[model samples]
Target chain A: MRRLISMLCLVGVVLFGACALGKVEISGLFMKQAGYQESDIRAMTEEFLKMRPDIDVKLSFVAYEELHDKIVVAAASGAGTYDVILLDCIWPAEFAEAGWLLDVTERLSEEDRADIFPEVLSAVTYRGRLYGMPWLNDWEYFFYNKKMLEAVGAKPPTYWTEVIDIARKLKAQNIVEYPIIDAWGQGEAVVIQWLQYVYAMGGTLFDEAGNPTMNEGKPLEALEFMVQHMDEGLFNPACIESFYEEVRRVFSAGQAAFGLNWTYMYNLANDPAESQIAGDAVIAVIPGFPDGRRSATCNGGMGLSILTSSQHPDEAWDYIQYLASKEVQKKYSQNALPIWKSLYDDPELIAQQPELIKVAKEQIHYIFDRPQVPWYSQLSLILSEELQAALTKAKTPKQAMDDAVSRTKEVMERYAQ
Target chain B: MHSKVPPTPSGMYPRGGLLRRRETAFAWALILPSFVFIGVIIFYPMGLSLRLSLFQVDLTRRGAGTPFVGLANYIDILKSGYFWSSVGRTAYFTVVSIAIEMVLGLFIALLLNEKFRGRSILRSLLLLPWALPITVDAIMWKWIFNANYGAFNALLQQLGLIEKYQPWLTRPWSAMHCVIAADVWKVTPLVALLLLAGLQTIPRELYEAAEVDGAGWFRSLWKITIPLLGPTMTVVLVLRTLDAFRVFDIVYVMTQGGPANATKVISFLTYQEAFKFLHFSRGAALSYLITLIVAVLALLYTRAMKRQIEY
Candidate 1:
């Protein structure tokens, strides 16, 4: 019995020592939809695991809609639920303000900072402090069925005016019921699309003195333009109920001559298995107003962030660095563009999707951000509801903008207090 | 199957003895776990939310201290246009759906109560809609009402009722009605089952006596059936009203309170305030208001139920 007891004690010590040298387990939260596909992420993780067998990663996914609230809840509880999380560009202000994200400004080297696009880096920065590494690089691009444009004997449009003329011809000839389709749904999608128009029109939501400028100038004009075009049946009425997925489906169905969506749509739109107008679908720069500015696109990049409450912050940061590394990102450039500006010049990288890389080079130059505020969610809600009111004719464009202007001013003032 | 056992003596369970004490102690021991469970599961959150609501707890405001600004959150909610409009929408959903459901449920229950062929199979089949999960039911209805390729539009088109497919969920007014329709469709079956149970309890002799005295079917329905079914109807209304007034899942799956916030019910608003915006105190206050509204509604209904109709 004494010998058996000593042998058991020896076994217990061995097991504990083995455990001390075992894998460091960390979990990451990623959205199942858009940007990097699930299979791509799993493959990336598998590769990462092969390289670092001493570290174990557990990945979980939620829909994009649930990602924000899920992060907020997990962070608020201080539960260390996730070590790494996918961060939307619009969320950094709110998350950083809540102190839910790790401050990693000093971790980025000068060489690393210089290689990445400044606009891409801004997605992960709040108040000049870097919080994460930019991973998915996405922006809206104009898509058109080449056949429909050819049927109307029109060339590819460079200006909003030229697009309008082509859309008019397409409508008059009965080539399509609606020449243009967009996602103007009642959420962040609506605000992003609307802001793209506002940016294209050379409009700012605030003046130099930080006064609200939504009720006048091009912001008001943008809303009026949408209401008028929708009434003329140029914009699809169904867009009011559509999100990005719906926009992709509608554009792929050959029901619309023109549409705007993020990078994922380009591949899906041309896939023979997914689309009816597979080969004819072409991507170009989203048009801008000739009188106002050059091409404008809404920045839709997301980032790899380490949660402040993560127990294994070093392991999480290592995983994020691996995911956002130039080589890994360049290899997985099927769904999205790489954030590194140098990759755009790489022969093999450009060879994968030459047309997209060519347009993305110019499009990235014109990328504009959504308003980065801590109360952005509230501001987004106000924008979505007011924009819908104008679209649905519940209020005139002027009235809707006026209400939005006042509410925006009030929210800013509250924050200022 | 065997010989009968004798009855226990009257003193077997003496009220004032040591065995009684031991039995009492055992009963208390068995009940203690559930009592603690109720306190933890139900009362703990209630207390936490109540405490949180009294303070200004906006997480997004970073270092802003959570001050005890009692009743300020409630006042702000009452003053907000969003809250009042959401309340109006919730009321519209509850009243319109319950009115239609009660009438339709009673009519279906009356028909099912009659002698018929394949009655047993029909009765069992009636439960399918009620048995479906709300998420699945809402998703099914969302597809059925899809603007581009929906079964409803196809049916309407085939019948020459319209020239083109209508955007049913795109419009604010129509979207609310579509949501109410989805809720009503899933719930009316359960309502019918409840009414059918009440129908079974009605004595057929009352109808026979009335018929002998020259009363017709409509008269018997109006004079006898309706009044006796009052208690069951009251119970159904209370359940349906509470459920409809706090609707979130169907609206969430279908419209998500879209197209100018037309279908934004109170619970959806509360969710947006708390989680989406991270204004915990405001959300807590909004949820407490919901609790108060439901409690008051249930009380009024039970009061009506208590004043039972006399024959």
Candidate 2:
């Protein structure tokens, strides 16, 4: 009996030791190309450990498109595999609504709350609750080849009409093959650009009750303007199939005179090896509408959230806070735009990377988020289809908008009660 | 009464009696692990999907419970024009892609059957497309089909075939055809290899006998080659048909069923419904519907296989 007790005690001690040494797994969509290197992550992990040595952090990198799917699968199975997650801004509503994330509103201090941008905060908030911390903030900015603009005897366009006029002039000069390019593929990227144009033209997609009103005249007028640009050859018809990478390639090759893209392209465009006109490229705000209202760019960024099933919420929250801190944000700003407002004004960093600073400041006033809803992903797809149909001449602008509104209403009604 | 009077020794007992029972139990134990694996991995999820399909669950709502709503998901999916259209589109893609692949694959296999110089090298080269990953192939084709800078348009313009670039993946019919072309290019090699294996089993003596009878090449082919190749062709067709029916990766990467869902297949639609739309239950329902159709095909294939075996 004594020997048996000793054997059992030995087993218990071994199990305890195994459990004690286990690492807290935090899954995120970080890639080397996206500027999150393993060495950098390891350095960050060391810093985190110095802050709290009791916690052992294990990071799992997932591809961007696969991240949400992995989280959904893991969360639905009640698996505490992912204690921390990096989510897209639009995903928080669906994830939090699904009870997959821990509500961090009460955990955040008032000062911490004040540090985050309001637009980002609104994106991560659902039903008066915060579910995520903003990490990186992205918005579209206008990019123009300074040399090409000069060669065409034109200046950078500041308004929508000016943009069209410059394209027309460039086309007549035959200086560049494609005058302007934007991501107009049948995906979220195209929908994001379309929304910017629609809002610039003073169109609204939803009413006070959160009901879709895209069939209205204002929205139609906005879509007509977009189609007119395509029809007039200001924008390439090939844009119907072009994605972000394609746009980047065309602009980098100096075949395109002007382009509108997210802030991440700034660094790539500035690289002399990758770009033909690297030093001569300039960044500015997207051209405003004829009515003087500046176009709103769709928000594109990632947020950090803690899973509700996590056994290490406190540790995960610490990591989130660390990522959102001013120091880390400054370091992150060197590669990608950090969401914290303080980093935008950092003189040293701005002086070192003027184009990045220009993009940060110019995009601040025009940043807008997609609809905050659990079904936003689906809604975005529906919007993309309808808009593409109009752009491709498969459906008239009015008919397409009407179809989108009706379909959106149907989906909203299905989810309402 | 006689046996009770004098029970046989244990060793003297018939080996079939006790040993058979033990062997049966041992066999079951060996198979039990595999049975459990299949039940957990395949059947359990399928059963859960079946249950979810009957419920009104979004899985995207916070604290929202899956409420029982029998046949509602099915009714909704059936009622939607989008669902039926995607199904029709998927069927069209499968039939056309499989037919073209089979014909082209058979022709290539026959051509390669002839003894030639660098025959081994040619066989290795044939596998290049099949060896490449589906995503890699899709991306390569996307660039190749690019309207302006693509190799196809460049070649066409060089030959003075057309003055301008064609929007290959933008228009409705052209987009679907372009995807089919890419699909056929990537998978025809696989079908060719399978048919080549079938051709290798054909005896040379039969062709010699046909030659002695003055039967031409086409006559011998029709009389000897095809009849003997029946079982192999059936297997290849069944496998390719099923694979083509579930085609997703190529379309997803290339066009994303784009330009107004012109090339949207059933799998893509289910994926969009589940992951993209967060309508998990609805997506599960659609998946089961697809499974049912595929299962019917599998049953037919099984019957055909049984007939082949009997023959």
Predicted structure with the largest TM-score when compared to the true one:
1
Q: How do the residues A1-417 of candidate 1 rate in per-residue lDDT, one tens digit apiece?
A: 999999999999998997988989899999976788888899999999999999999999987877998999999999999999999999999999999999999888989999988888999999999999988888889999999999988999998889888889999999998888899988888888888889999998989987878889999998888888888888888889888888889899998999999988889999999999999999999999988888899988899999999999888888889998988998899898998988889999989989999989888788998888899999999999999988877889899989998998888887776
Worst lDDT run of 10 residues, candidate 2 chain B, spans: B1-10
Give the per-residue lDDT digits (tens) of candidate 1, residues B1-311: 01222344877855556776776678789999999999999999999999999999998896887999999999999999889999999999999999999999999899999999988898899999999999999999988988777898999999999898887888999999999999989999999999999999999999999999999999999998889899899999999999998999998888878888989999999999999999999999999999999999999998888887542
TM-score of 2: 0.91
- lDDT by residue (B1-311, candidate 2, tens digit) is 22332355876545456755675678789999999999999999989999989987788764567789899898888898998899899899998998999899988999899999999999999999999999999989988889768888898889999888776887777889889988999999999999999999999999999999999989998999888888888898899878988999989888988877888899999988887767888999999889888989889988988798788
Q: What is the C-alpha lDDT of each candidate?
A: 0.90, 0.81
lDDT of 2 by residue, A1-417 (tens): 999999999999998987887755454434333334456656776787788766667777754555667787878778787887777778877887778889888888898788677877776777888888877666778888898788767877778888888888888888865688887888787788888887777677888877788888567777888788888877877788877767777888887888888765677777899887787778888887878367677777667788888887887888878867777667656556766666667797787677678756766777777887778887888988998899889999999999999989888877776
Considering only chain A, what is the TM-score of each predicted structure? Answer: 0.94, 0.88
Backbone clashes per model, in order?
A: 0, 2
